[model samples]
Target: MMLENKVVAITGAGRGVGREIALLCARHGASVVVNDPGVGGGGEGGDAGPAQQTVDDIITAGGKALANLASVADPVGAQSIVEDAVQHFGRIDAVVNNAGILRDAIWHKLSLEDWRAVIDVHLNGAFNVSKAATPYFREQNSGSFVHFTSTSGLIGNIGQANYSAAKLGIVGLSQSIALDMARAGVRSNCIAPFAWSRMTASIPAETPEQQARVERLKTMSADKIAPLAVYLASDASQGVTNQIFGVRKNEIVLFDKPRPVRSMTKTTGWTPEAIADELIPAFRPSFARADEVSADVFPYDPI
Candidate 1:
């Protein structure tokens, strides 16, 4: 009962990781608000069945829960999700920004429409929900924000320029919120989850390697990511803000925020030639490989 008497709002709770988190949070004593417009993988079309089903599951389990069919991409809709939680439950304790859509494309071929579509739902959507919850969090003097990021952004990926940009932007958003709200007893953190879901299913699997990767991913269930998210949403994670975590099946990883790994300071700012000779050589060994993608960074099977 880590979350007894608490209320949590979770976006994208219709299925997959979001659904798992919502259900687990309710089980741990938090009144849950399950929000999902039930859009397809590419953000096209919508339905209410997914969100309602999650709510039904929670209620059937004897937990307090409610369903909210709203697109997090819409500022007004996003606000309603938070407002609904407060109106129904009397207070809000945590917000999980998990709604997302994929429109993967290589950088050269990526269109403006796809770029905006991805950004609107992922980066802007996260901001919209978090912003709507800020006042309540500030007044209550306690709240948590658990944002979903991805290795496609944290590490690297192929043909996901828009997705990568939005995901990385969310990391920055999470960090900034953590720093800005620390004094108000608010916490913000990110999770780079590795799971097989509708999002992953959209990845092109035409090649042998790509198909193999998908098969490997199928072994990792969406539920495997819920425990850490539930912990972050509860009082148990006090003093655990401003962190980025990776959840791959049974393994959990903490990531170091970007910092100077190798430094070579030129007292008198060097010319281009001098930098080429000295700084480049000094930093070469520490430089990450330009070709490495998410799979390369995590070559082993999920543990």
Candidate 2:
């Protein structure tokens, strides 16, 4: 019962990794707030069924939980979610920003609507919830935040520019929060989970072979991602902030902090023409090819 007597509010807990995280946190003796507007993978349409069902399951298992039907992108809705946790459970010790939506489109074909929709749900949504909980964390002198990043963003993916941008932005936001809240005993970290969820189910299989890969990946359930999330939400991960961790089945990967790999200098300065001629040639060998995608990098069996 690492999280005994603690309350953790999880966004998008209606399904996917968020749902698993909520269930695990409850099992670990934490009061849970399952907040999800119950939107589809594309962020279209909403239902209350998923959130309520998760809450019901937790209660049936002899755990404390409440259902919150709120869009994480809505500042007021986000604030009320945190308030509800406090009023019902007395205090919130952790916040899991797992709410998100997908709007996949290649850069040229990506519409303004698609870009805004993803950013609103992912980046801005993280802001809304974290901002709402900041004062509470500070007042209580402690808290934890586990924000979701993605390999799509960490590496690169074709047709997911919007998603990649938002996911990477969450990492930047988490790191800044870790720096700000360190002295208050509050910590923030990011998780780049590689789990099979509805989103993966949505991937179009153009051929039988492609379809088989997706089917095999189905075995890598969202449950695998929950353990690291719960650990980060508990006192066990205290001071383990500002780091990015990955969960792909049983494999746990720690990404190095972004650092400069190469530098070019001139006693004076180099002109754009000079950089193009000199720097480009000097660094081109180290630059990752634009065609490389997530699958090429993480070829391990998802199962």
Candidate 3:
């Protein structure tokens, strides 16, 4: 049992990816807290049915779980959710920051309200839950955080400015937390998943003849994305942190770390024209691949 005796709290566990993760964790021997406010895809208020349903499913599968009906967007509520996990299961060993909402629009057409609502739920909600769990993790001297980013965040997507920004912010946050928690035996990583979740249901099929093609391309199941997450949260990945992975059907690609390129040294000032003509080119998009240049040409030197 990879997660024997572990305690995991997952936000948005009422449905979709979060629910899948909760079930998997419980099956591997973890005591799970399925947290959700039962909100719909648009983030509207609702009952706790979704969360309870997940719990019932887990119990039926012979797994241990508790349903938590709390809004991840509320810091107080998030804190209480963690407290409930500790109260029921003794300690929290991991957290899956999987709660999110979407508001899609092109850059110029996006309203302030639309942007704020998405950012509040996706980015701020991650903060609320992670902030509450950090103390517990530090005290235990070990923990794992699996944050859900998206391909829209990694690359870019039309009609998703708000969602992309929020998801990218989570990746940055996860990296920083990885550094802060390194010595405490904690690990943090993000996953950019391509899965068939409720969030992508509205994407239009480009042509009637291409309907099957569209369905094929969009039908990567939530279960397919969970194994990588499970590995990251388990003990096998103790040495891995501060990384991002793109997971889809039968494929997992590691994202590259950011690197600097094209350093220029000048002992004297240059004219604006020279700066524009020379410096700009050195920093152009083409220079991004300069890291692959022959290392022998820039051999290590001691001064």
Candidate 4:
């Protein structure tokens, strides 16, 4: 009963990882708010069935739950999700910014429309919900935020320029929220999860490598990510914030934040030519492999 008497609002809870987290949170005694517009993988069209189904299941299991068919991409709709939590449950304890869509295209061929679409849903959507929930959290002097990031941004991926940028931006957002809201007893953290969800199913499998990677991903289920997410939302994880974690099947990993790896300085700062001659060679060995993708970094089978 880690979350007994608490209320948790989860975006994208209609299906996949988000759904699992919502169910688990409810089972652990939290009154759950399952929010999802039921949009497609690329953020088109919508249905209310998904969110309602999640709530139905929770209630059948003897748990408290509510459904919200609001698009996280809209600020007003996002605000409604939080408001619904407070209006119904009387208080809100956690917000999980898990709503997202994928619009994959190579950097050059990626259209402005596609770029903005991805950012609006992933980056701006997270902000909208978090911003709306902030005042409530601040006033209550307690709250938790669990944001969904991805390996495509943390490591690398092909034909996902917009997605990568949005996911990485979420990391920065999580860090800032954690720092700025600490005095309010609020915690924020990110999870870069690997699972065979609708998002992964949409990845292009044109290449042999991609097909292989997709096959590998099929072994990991969305439920494997629920435990960590529930823990983050609960009081048990009181001191854990401003961190990044990865969950792949049976494995859980703590990721290091960006930090200076190597440094070089000249007593008198030199010209570009000097930098080329001195800096390039000194940093050559430490340079990250430009060609490495998520699969390349995690070549081993999911365990």
lDDT for each residue of candidate 3 in 209-292, tens digit (9 for 90 to 100): 335434754657887777787788788889899999877678787887667656666568778887898888776865534322
lDDT of 1 at 152: 88
State the lDDT of candidate 2 residue by residue for 1-303, as single tens digits: 989999999999999899999999999999999999988999999999999999999999999999999898899999989999999999989999999998787699999999999999999999999999999999999999999998888888778999999999999999999998999999999999877888777666788856766766777889999999999999999769999999888889898777887899977799999999999899998887788877777766743
For 1-303, candidate 1 gives per-residue lDDT tens digits of: 888999999999999999999989999999999999999999999999999999999999999999999888899999999999999999999999999999988899999999999999999999999999999999989999999999889987999999999999999999999999999999999999999999998988999988988898999999999999999999899999999999999999999888879887888999999989998998999999999898887778977
lDDT score for residue 266 of model 3: 56
* Candidate 2 stretches greater than 4 Å from native: 207-213
Clashes of 1: 0
Q: Which ten residues in a row have the lowest lDDT in candidate 4?
A: 294-303
Of models 1 and 3, which has the larger lDDT? Answer: 1
> What is the Å distance of residue 65 in model 2 from its true position?
0.3
Clashes of each: 0, 0, 0, 0
Q: Give the worst 10-residue stretch by lDDT in candidate 1.
A: 294-303
Candidate 4's displacement at residue 266, Å, is: 1.0
Clash pairs (backbone) in predicted model 1 = none
CA shift at 96, candidate 3, in angstroms? 0.3
Query: Once superposed on the true structure, which residue ranges of model 1 sit more than 4 Å away at CA?
Result: none
Residue 190, model 3: lDDT of 94
Q: Rate the local accuracy (lDDT) of all candidates.
A: 0.94, 0.91, 0.83, 0.94
lDDT of 4 by residue, 61-176 (tens): 99999999998889999999999999999999999999999989888999999999999999999999999999999999999999999988998788999999999999999999
Give candidate 4's root-mean-square deviation (CA, Å). Answer: 0.9
Worst 10 residues of 2 by lDDT: 294-303
